[model samples]
Target chain A: MGDVVLASLLLPLAGAVAAAVAPARRTVAVVTAAGQTVLAVVLAVTVLRDGPVATAPGGWEPPLGIALRVDGVAAAVGLLAAVVVTAVLAHACASPASTGPATEPAAGRSAYWPLTLLTLAGLQAVLVAADLFTTYVALELLTLGAVALVALGGRGAYGPALRYLCLAVLGSFAFLVAVALVYARTGTLTLDLAAAALPPGPALTTALGLATVGLLVKSALFPLHAWLPDAHAAAPTAVSPLLSALVVKGSFVVLLRVWTALGGDAALASVLAVLATGAVAWGGVLALRAAALKRVVAYSTVAQVGYLVLLLPLVTPALAGGDGVAVDVARTAWQGVLLVLLAHGLAKAAMFLAAGTLVGVAGSGRVADLGGTAARAPVVVTAYALAGVCLAGLPPSLGFVGKWALLDAALTGGRWWVVAVLLGGGLLTAAATARVLAATLREPGPGDGPPPGTPHGREEAPGATALPTPRAGERWPALALALLAVVTCVGSAWLADLVLVGAPPGVGG
Target chain B: MSTAEVYLVLGGVVTLLGAVRLLTTRDRLAQVIALNVTGTGTVLVLVALAATGGGEPDPVLHALALTGIVITVSVTGLALVLVRRLDREDDGG
Candidate 1:
């Protein structure tokens, strides 16, 4: 089982190398993606059956060698990421060669595959990393691959990609500085060692602040989120799913782990809670007003992450004298937040992929120009609707399950304000989604002729791009991912069961 | 203060200064330079920490230093590409 865990990390990396060497385009995409999916499944099963597994590289002990540990959370995230990567690869395999002249040589495609693979490996590494220094390294690797993938879209993508690269590097440096401080103060890089060395001292506090700020920037939580809208909106559609779905969550997972390992300081927890509320309100408002389809989804991400931040306060066990109701609320809230993260990954990936198809077919992403598109692209529209259901926390979706849990938690914890904010955020998200649907469903204006057929268009023209409409074949991947997002609601029972098994005693609803 | 402590603070100051410049500067080229300086300062700080023998010079830190160098170069290349593209677009317009 341990070997399987190790192999899961190595398989994508190996496939990436092979993809680079393979001559055929189909071979590169299928081989690497399929291999990763299989590895993801194997690792998920191992984690479910065996529980969290830790392995130290090169026979070194804690605080000296790097350690990888896959707990319930890491396994779930790994499996989810695998499903997303496979779906993306399937889409890439079936879609036509992107319309632009090949800015990258044949070899560059091979290089691209390897970079993505390395990124997946890095994400898995970060999830399982037991030491702060190892986590920092994994984060840097993830950023490098993501930045390259952003730039892979050719000249038009250069500006946004450059900005992403700069901001990401800035975030990485801040994180590294924090890691250095922690090590200097504690004389050990491992989380266990640092926790043993902790008492909320100045150095540790500074380290925590720097690390939190860096991760927030990377996660693109509101205010620090200026780079995300452009990066997600501008990147190639195929690349957008991975960027929005998997990469951002990677940092959040680390933040959660760090918070857990740090033994849950009250002041720090409250600070995170405050920031989360702000993120929910600010991101929701911005998402509601965005005009571009992709930008709307991107802004929604900023809001969605707020729910995860709220989990920090909930994860700490309540004192014995505290209300028993509060304890149950905290556990329920934690589970809700985790489910939200999982469901959001699936739904966001589907939304981005579907939006890409719509953009590909209609040649514009502006809500105003997407008129009559829902009629033309029923399947795509349905996919969007399903994804929106999850995003809005509507019934029979995993998203609803998450929101219910959170609302219950907030109410029990006497945090009525958080509950109110969650409800308001949900309503705002629904309104934003409705705005897009309304524009797409409406009849074309009298002055408006049939929308342009091409995918690429004049800079000034709203919907004049010349790319081909999505055929039946191109729609399956989006549909499949969307279905998974919905089916996640059913799977929640099983996930909840697993989470309960691992959860501390007396910590549940 | 120990040399290690002095260098660590110095590195932090340098990185903080570079970050401020990067954010405030309008010139694309200058922004890239500021970012690079920030990266350099970060690496220096990490090296300083390792030298202090607080932590055992863990391989992860070494790995991070290598990763930082590679990423900095790659970002520099990408930034230059964007600068060139902007120049081209301006000329064409």
Candidate 2:
């Protein structure tokens, strides 16, 4: 089992190297992506069938050696990431070879695939990291790879990517400083060891505060979200899914692990909850007001992440309230958070891919310019609509299921204000989605003939068909992921069982 | 305060100063330099902690320092490229 866990991290990294060295573009991209996906799926299954898997790189243990451990949450997220990466790579494979006067430089294309694979490796490393130092390394890997991917959007994207790079580096620095302080006081860097070694003191408090602020910046929770819209909106469409859906969640997962390993605290948790509530409201309002399709989805990410942060406060029974009641509320909150993460990962990726295809066809991402898009690309439109429903937390979808669970937890915890925020955020998301849908459904007015000066004539060229069409082949991947998001809700009972497998009996709920 | 404590305090102040400079600087290159300085300060602080041997040099801190170095280098490289790209875009017709 340890060997399997180690192999899970190593194989993708090896595949990434092979992909880089492979001369053929098509072979390297396809093989690397497929190999990583298969490895991820197999490992996820192994983690699910067995329990959390842990291993030291060599034979050392604890404070001396690094350990990687994966629980049910990590496995689920790993599986979701694998699915998203596979879908995006498949879409890239099918799309036209992007050789044009305006295509991104060859150097940029060369850098993209390798960095993407590296990013996947980093994410996997993060999911399983059992020590603070290893987790920090994994996060740095993720940030570097992500910054590179963001810059691949070419001229229009460089500014945003640079901004993101700066903010991410600063966050990493802050986190590193905190890790140093913790090490200085506790004499150990492993989270479990630190928890054992250090008593509650000023050093610990400072460490936690610094680390929390760094994560808040990296997660782009609210006020620190200055870089997200531009970075997400301008990145290559294929890149957006991974960035918005997977990378940010990686940091949040680490934060959870840190809190858990530290035996969990109430005051810090409440601070996080209050911030989360603010994020939900702020992100939703901003998302509703965005004019670009990608920007809207990016803002929606802010809202969804707030929901995940809410789990931090609600996870501890003491934070929620008294014995049985608090326990039940916390359990519900955990399940809600997990479900939301799963659903949002699938739905958001699908939505981005669908938007990518639509933008490819229309040659624009302006929401207003998308008028009559549903007429020309009904399948893509349908995919987008389904994704939107999931985003809005409409009934019968996974979003709805997750939100319902969240509300139940909120209500049970006597946190009526959080419940109100969740509902309002959902309604705002619905309205924003409707705005896009309405635009797309509108009839083509006299001025709606493929926005002035668009290269409509060029689109009719022989090789132009290679550009994504809403036709059957291009539609299935997005539709399938979107459907998976909806279907996962039905598997809630099984997921709940899995989440509680190793948990102390009756302690969880 | 002990010598080690004084050194740690100085390192922390330097790190914070570098961070503030990085955030407030208008020139991209200057910001990158400030970021590098901040990273160096962090490393110095970690090394100081290791030297004290109060608990034994934490391997986790070593790993974090190594990772931070790699990330800082990569980001600096990328930032240079972005700055060049911005300049080119501006110069282009």
Q: TM-scores of the first chain across all predictions?
A: 0.91, 0.92
Residue pairs whose backbone atoms clash in candidate 1: A454-A465, A454-A466, A454-A467, A455-A465, A455-A466, A455-A467, A456-A465, A456-A466, A457-A465
**What DockQ does each candidate score versus the true complex, computed on alpha carbons?**
0.50, 0.69
- For every candidate, the chain B TM-score is 0.86, 0.79
- Candidate 1 lDDT tens digits, A301-394: 8889888888877766552224677678767877888888988999998888888777765566777777767767889888888888898888
Candidate 2 Cα errors over 4 Å, as ranges = A62-64, A96-102, A317-322, A452-473, A500-509, B52-67
Cα lDDT over the full model 2:
0.76
Q: How well does model 1 score by local distance difference test?
A: 0.75
Question: What does the lDDT read for residue A312 in candidate 1?
Answer: 75
Best by DockQ: 2
Q: What is the lDDT of residue A408 in candidate 1?
A: 85
